[model samples]
Target: MSNKTFFSLHGGVNVIGGTKLHLTSGTDELIFDFGATYEPGKGRFDQVLTVRPGRETEDSRAAGVIPNLSYLYSPTPSKHVAVFVSHFHLDHVGMLSYLDPSVPVYLSQPSFNLLRQLEVVGEGIGTHRDLRVFPYGEWIDFGRLKVLPLPVEHDIPGATGFYVKTPEGTLAYTGDFRGHGLHPEVTTAFFARLGELGTNILVSEGTRACEAPRPDAYSESEIGTVIESAVRPGKSAFFMIYNRNIDRIATFARAARSLGRELVLTPATHHLFRTLSPEEYRLARPAVFVTQEFRVKGLPPWIAGLDVPRLTVPDIAREPARFLTELPYANLNELVDLRPDGGSCFIHSDGPPLGEFDPAFRNLKQWLRDFDLALVFARSSGHASPEYLKECVNLANPDILYPVHTANMAAMPTPAHGILAVSQLYQKYYIPGRRG
Candidate 1:
């Protein structure tokens, strides 16, 4: 029971999505982030096409998209593995739907609420019912290990990092964080607590820790300024952004309001906004254009109660400059009705294309060209830069460092700490020491 072992089930090297890490303290096995990968062509799964039915897990297992953790799928009860999720991102929890029903899945209260709402609205991707709301700042104890979920700032709400008091030593895992997000204090507090706890091994995400520098980057507050400066009063503005990014939406709403323009949102986007931030929703209500399509029969009570203005595509075409609307790539057909003039600006606040391999990006570029709208991009990455990562490593000062969630390990910046271990998938790293 004294020998502690660690290995990654996925996301070991040159992998982006499917991030699953396994740590064992003499049969007290714990699995963190049993998520799915986003390599569409290789894994043969994407936003449009899904795995073969009735064999989701089996086919994924065969394709190496998900690990064949036999213990999880055993028909008879053998060993119970505790599964913990850090956030609500699909890439981080996409595979949860296919997991064994017997295994317990833990998630933050906010994440649970968001998922529940999505499930109710029919946008949920088969959420597991065996979910427990994982509380922050409190440690949940197993026989030999204790896990503490700590809140961290990211693009989405309920993003968390885990602090595991293992048999070997304290291990800190930063589950996708950024200092430049809406709440810098959240990240600062996390590091402060990590410094106090004294982590021996630190597992961090290097999503943006690439050799190439992020262009036109701005802090959360500065994003509003950049957007405001980019557009004029007589021009229409359309933003292509993730609806889950509540902070970015709020910034856009505030900036649009300052410019005396209506911040028009698709019904789905408006639902997410009203559900996540009621106060911001109320504030942005006056300047928001709720689409006619949003006036459905089964409108949620909260959404129905809000006195939001319902606007049609023709309404926007009449006075395009009076609105800054949301138009995701999937809904590019709406642009035909809006008929935006050459003065319209398309602000691409989303991160760089998931690599040039993504076809959706090419389609989006073609659409923009066809519409003849000028393009502008202003965004802050959700992950810390390599230079800032070095600063975080210095601040935490862990004994061992393992960087995950990056494409190229060679281009990633190293931690200031002397010990850097490049661990392989399923290759056990023996950790020495035992928790009291």
Candidate 2:
């Protein structure tokens, strides 16, 4: 009845410190996500803003995993071959470069596509990281380890949860998910099948466990309508979302079409959409192409009018504000700078609140206030809410509950299930032993 293990690295509490389950079994050292650490209170941007490797604050990763991996021998001489990234966020894949390149890294098609764009754009230090792309739902074998990529709904396209079958049992890892009631329930049906698998040890995210369930969550249609309504006859829109957010990109495309305007995409985002989308979606390429879409020359005749506003990140970073004045704008009258009557969707698809807070989203809000912009936040996070977290626990009905990806790990509500806290050094957790 003892749940105590000879060795296991339950990551520290934070959105970035992904749970790294290292069993004592032979090279069964599979890392679910090699994310980074985040410490609040510093003026440093990287620390609070993104889960970047060696970001501002103390980089436990940069110093190299000490006591955490101290249990297992350092991964120097012996390459720990199995590394799976549920998604492409910096936190999920930040440590990829740090790991021995010899170890093969696996990511879902969409995620790998997005990561590739980010790397090419010089987004972060991830470019140096090595990775191998696996189609969703495929089973990949690494020595004795068998891994399956389970698609999950997140803000990002190609987001996935993983199902791992070890000698111990079948465990499901929900990388990050939100049951947004959208897309004709395909995603929900997909995840519901996970329950049918009778997965054991359902390790899940507790990021939104502190928040109440948001009813049905934002659906693609509702979001599109809101975004469409916001963008009127003239005004241009600017959204601050990570490049990995491809599903959101699809939503934007549909929304723009609804508004009779072409959806202009950043080259970075187009890079992701081209690779992650279905083979059919590759019929036509966007103007500002990133990676080559399936050997094709045109998009579906249905979307000929649907503009693929493809502008590069370099085009923007050189002069972010200039993106407004140039491409699809510029010569357009000031009245067209934005829709008349003030309709614009100013979305902040980031957390820890990008930019500076206080003056509202740092000074970005301040800069837009004069524009007389109509802000509509039509966005949904990928993390499950507290109610959904409880619902997930009910679905799998696990022997214990271990919530990662949040500072308030202790706050997660796991009534009947045992609270398995992956305590800090010397920290004690009395999780009920798995029933033999």
Q: Which candidate leads the pack in lDDT? A: 1
Per-residue lDDT tens digits for candidate 1, residues 134-225, read 77999899767899999988888889899888766777778788888778788878877887888887777777767566568677778998
Instruction: Return the TM-score for each candidate structure.
Output: 0.90, 0.70
Model 2: per-residue lDDT, tens digit, 372-396? 5554465666666666666666665
Question: How many steric clashes between backbone atoms does each model show?
Answer: 0, 8
Clashing pairs in 2: 230-343, 235-338, 235-339, 264-309, 265-309, 284-298, 284-299, 356-362
Task: Please report, in order, the local distance difference test score of every candidate based on alpha carbons.
Answer: 0.74, 0.53
TM-score, predicted candidate 1 vs. hidden true structure? 0.90
